[model samples]
Target: MTSSIRRIPRRMPGWAKVLTAFVLVLVVLFAGVRLAVLPGLRDLFGTETQDRSGPALLKSIQDMSRYDAASGNFQVVVDLEKDAKYLPDVLHGSRTLYVGAGTVDAYVDLGRLGGNDVTVDADRTSATLRLPHARLGKPALDPDRSYAVSKQRGLLDRLGDLFSDNPNSEQAVQKLAVRHIGEAAKDSGLTARAETNTTDMLQGLLSSLGFKEVHITYRS
Candidate 1:
């Protein structure tokens, strides 16, 4: 008598191979979304910043120009919020935050002048001046005066913030507040007053220098 045995096929079928590859691709995509993309998405809809302390935190930024003719000081309270949702229609998945008590400084620059800006009348009795338009300088936020108004974060957002290295959200709000203040100051005739003050000072100086008639004008 003779005995026989059957062997099972070891090679995978084409359909099964394709299905396996597809699953692997899905897993890789999911991982990428979970790790890399999610955090960015949070901030694309979010903001954050490093926490600085002490004198470093009280950073002062101003023009080095020695003469400041007129100054407009403003006090602003900013309340802001943001929300991020992987899906926007069905539900509100993002959180919002608030920042408050912001301030800004606007001043006129008299130290900046062209060489031929000042003209003297022929008799050495009168003088005229040409001045450039007034402009705003960079904003400097006073940390001590500012505060975090409030914040409400979703679970996903809180999770997202843990890993994000973006700039401080409060700083963004502070900047916006200061910007608005600067705009308002400009519109409220801050520059005009500055120009007037400058003219008065120059007139007084010219009088002391023995000039009788003074003519002043702005280039802008």
Candidate 2:
């Protein structure tokens, strides 16, 4: 009986051995699939599910100023010598005021042209400007007169408006303004124009005013 039991142990079936080997192989593959393969696949396909809330492109450009906690204001000084003509027209005639928290008031005095004041109020999404008086040549509208207007419409309406406007007239005005401003900047001996520096300065000022986002647009 002891010898028979020993023989039974030695003669175990090959099929059973092969089955055990296959089972071990499957267990290894299953572990690899769960730990490596699945995670890689999820990362490849699920990128949009990651943290999406962040500052917008325009907002990033705007918030480059340092705030004064004591005064409760953010300030950036712009020397208008370089582009004096463009500065006044763009600021007063064009209606493009620095949009941010509290109010943005611009004071400009250019010799014979005199001084003008512009105020822009901080609306959460955009700015609301109150123009007490803006004089541009004809006192109505002039090609050389720079001005900005803000409009709000649905996406579709904005797209339509872009096409419906007189393209040639707009181009002519833009070219004239650019040429005039370039000349004025050279004459004034300004190293850099205010428009170039205002975007980021306005944003930082707005942030100091407790706004998280700011959008500034140039209008004619």
Candidate 3:
């Protein structure tokens, strides 16, 4: 009778065993957090913001001398990206998508009216007024309405934010938003509408004051 010999398997190396165990532990922890813990934590701490700001101060106020005849509401989506000269975006780049909402006012500077702008005819029944073209005011951004849709930062940028006081400042995006709003306002014919409204207002007022013929002209 031939005797059968049993061959034993080789044992794994200490480092290999340790590595395998560590990997398994990591997988289990990740699964636990993702499947169970995170949801509970998020429910317990919903996205609620608290305001702790101090009362607003009353600064010096200036009287407004312009008539806001027309206002244009505008919204813009800004996509900004930055990349390193020789590095890939994953390593040293950032991309942001922002949604901005604002308003631009078209006005006539009544303060700029000249003494000789209004001319009365000798008959006292006709008058002529020379006015400057309507001008657009600065873009006024609505803080409560404007918001960031998304933001992506590279590994280096994420690491740098750990030491930064204000990591997510929206100054650049906000400036871009204001610029876009201003551009849109310039092309929207808001100033022309404002001029028409102002002229109509003046005609009605002058006619009520017994002027039958009211002639209004705009200068550059």
Candidate 4:
């Protein structure tokens, strides 16, 4: 007598099969359009960009009186999302992942110094200076280096873009990024670093001017 063996094949679920077919169709369509139609269209009709804005007017210039003690470069990632109640993300929601690069400058306002802010000793061998604490400037975002890493929009959003002028606006995310960067800079000891640098600079300058003793203090 010989032994017999039986084998049973597994079948994929109906929903899974449908989902796989849908995904495959989308992929094929996207690939075909990207590899075939896009290049042909570009070759047939080359693209041209035009700038129609008027020449920039010269704005009023103000004299700067602050000493830039330290400049801090910062980067932040902003993830902004909006969801509709009881609606799936694919149907009515948006999410954006943005990477923002910016710079914050800490400065001391030398122009605010009063006549008595700096005092020289009668012997001309010692000096004392009173200066204000360093303040951080507004965050300036770098457009070249800052950009959206990824964006996901619902079907309704995509449909609305067809009629909207500014379809892809990153203003919300950009603002959030700037705010985060500013907060980070405040906690990064940037102001302390700036104060140290300013003190060192003033001390060196005064010493070079023949003052053997230089004392510097900052006002809150």
Candidate 5:
């Protein structure tokens, strides 16, 4: 009778151990499915979100850049809502005029007219300008057009050309910018919901001018 009782307890222990092992295996499988398999499937088959307005914005920027040099009446309308945090003061305070040929000249308020002129050469290779307190050297102007400088080989020019040549480059840049913007919004205590408002405002203004994409980098 005592031996039988001991055997019953021994059997109970074995059964309990088996049940625990089975539960552990089930838990592991459940986690694996939820964490790994589902995410993999979604990445493989999910529909990509496309920004439909990008093309129109890019076209507008290109058109603004292509203004005729003879007219001297070109205007670049910036969408403030999309890029207000970084662009508002610059756009409203400083006036950037497109010189009929290909150059861009910006004049900032210094309490007087013609106080300063920051000239970005036509080829987009170099810049020449006189700031309020700083003086810049004269750029070597191209013989064909006395007002604009010849295209120079530079790191920035090379990178810009690379992005222009590769389709993936632009997408990569957009992704990076979006990530940075998200981070900025978080750090600034701004809600992500505001992004839509900014993007919409920008789209409206850019669509009118035919700009498909505007890549902005903030400086100190």
Candidate 6:
């Protein structure tokens, strides 16, 4: 029995196994940083390096003061039903329940500012800018978060589903949901916050660039 027993194979050194695992971990980490993490970080902190106008360099680059401060993700379950006006409901019937998520962004646009909207003091010590009214961007539906929660279709509708083309009530529900998200953004006071944030950011930036006084105003 002892002679028949299989000989044991030599084990690898503990240090060699540890080194292999460490290399694998490093490769994974590097791959993740390169593929996913770095690109997003770059966009969040990206800045333009346009020339600083004038010898004194008191230029007001009223370049779009984009404030992506107010962000909202809204989830809504919308029910859509086809109506039978003056006819039997069973003839056309339907209902689709959708669970959708929408993303909205509100920004303060200084893009309306022209050369006259910016005022730079003679000694480059003071500056003032007139900013345009803040506005909300279009609501975008996130396909990942947006989908049909549950749909109950009438027999005729289910039969029609197999056929060629027909108007989708779900699309109408989605459009309404998107419009609601946009209205919600306006009611959420995003514009006020964007204005305040833009003002503070421009003040600090100008103050740092040798301007002792910075004035920022918004117009409707």
TM-score on alpha carbons, each prediction: 0.57, 0.19, 0.77, 0.80, 0.14, 0.63
Instruction: Give a tens-digit lDDT track for model 1, residues 55-160.
Output: 6465688657633566665666665655554645223343334333433344455676777988876789978778776555555556676676565545445445
- Candidate 5 lDDT (Cα, whole model)? 0.34
Q: Choose 1 or 6, whichever is better by TM-score.
A: 6
Q: Which pairs of residues collide in model 3? A: none
Best by TM-score: 4
Between prediction 5 and prediction 6, the one with superior lDDT is 6
**Which pairs of residues collide in model 6?**
none
Model 5 clash count equals 15
Task: Per model, state how many residue pairs clash.
Answer: 5, 8, 0, 0, 15, 0
Q: What local distance difference test score does each model get?
A: 0.64, 0.37, 0.91, 0.89, 0.34, 0.76
Cα RMSD (angstroms) for every candidate in the order listed: 10.9, 26.8, 7.8, 12.6, 24.5, 21.6
lDDT of 2 by residue, 1-220 (tens): 3554444457659999998986876686466557656757656554365677877555344432222111111222111211234334333222212111111122211222212322344556444222122111111123232332332233333234447855212343344444444343343423223332444566677778876656543322
- Model 2 clashing-pair count: 8
Error of model 5, residue 75, in angstroms: 20
Where is model 4 more than 4 Å wrong at Cα? 1-37, 43-46
**Model 4 per-residue lDDT tens digits across residues 41-107:** 6566555789999999989999999999999999988999999998999978999999999999999
- Give the least accurate 10-residue stretch of model 4, judged by summed lDDT: 28-37
Q: What ranking emerges by lDDT with the best candidate at the front?
A: 3, 4, 6, 1, 2, 5
Candidate 5, residue 8: how far the Cα is off, in Å: 99
Top model number, lDDT: 3
Candidate 3 residues 47-149, lDDT tens each?
7789999999999999988889999999999999999999988878999999999999999988888989989999899999999999999999999999999
Model 5 agreement with the true structure over 97-155: per-residue lDDT tens digits: 11111122222212221423444446544433332321111122122332211222223
